[model samples]
Target: MKLSNEVKFNYPREDIWKALHDPEILKHAIPGCEGLTLQEDGSYDVSMSLGVAAVKGKYNGKVYMTDIEKPNKYLLEAEGSGSPGHVSMKMDCNLEETEEGCLLKWDCDAEIGGKIAGVGSRALGGIAKFMAKKFFDDIKKQLKKGAYTN
Candidate 1:
């Protein structure tokens, strides 16, 4: 599946970039995230429990950031599996400085298999969009509360 969206933050791109790489900030922004550990290779090992429609499971995943251009853009690669299924995604994120703060735009391609894929593309697409929105919403809240500031 393909997904794309944009979110505006009331902070500078540098601050937003720092927050994006912070495991503590991500653990709170990501839905159902239980733990997030940064690895030596700059990848993150993540564990979370998620429920989407009739599918519910615990997922363990690795997230890697590449092609990073600090405070501007990067690529994210992730893969995970659970009892319900497996999923992998690659996304490109761009940060644009705005008058108010910054704009984060993302485009992603994802693949799924097993019981989760059986849930139908329409349902999966909706769930993906919802989850993306929720993630950004959580980030917005954290930023507003100064949870990610240095």
Candidate 2:
């Protein structure tokens, strides 16, 4: 699957970048995130629980950031497994100053196998898009509030 989105945040690019790298902020912004731990070498370990139309489960995953260009751009790659399936994705994220604050653009490609794929591709795409939108919206709200707690 392929996903793309653009989000406008109420915070400066630097602040948004900081929040993006912060495990605390990520745990809050990500849907169903139970825990996120930062590791050495700019990697992260994450756990989340999610239930789509027909696929429901908890996923434990590892993510790493690479090709970073300071506060401007980076590449993120992540993969996770649940009881019945697993998903792996790679995304490129770019940030820039906008009239409102910061503009973030991301393009992602994902591969899924096992039971989750049994739910059907179209349904999964819809669910993933909804979840991604919600995540970005939450981030925008958090930025507006200066910080998000718990």
Clashing pairs in 2: none
TM-score list, all predictions: 0.96, 0.94
lDDT of 1 at 92: 100
What's model 2's overall lDDT? Answer: 0.89
Quote the RMSD, in angstroms, for model 1: 1.2
Clashes of each: 0, 0
Model 2 regions lying over 4 Å from their true place: 148-150
User: Ten-residue segment with the worst summed lDDT in candidate 1?
Assistant: 141-150
Distance from true position, residue 83, model 2, in Å? Answer: 0.9
**Where does candidate 1 stray beyond 4 Å?**
148-150
lDDT to native, each model: 0.92, 0.89
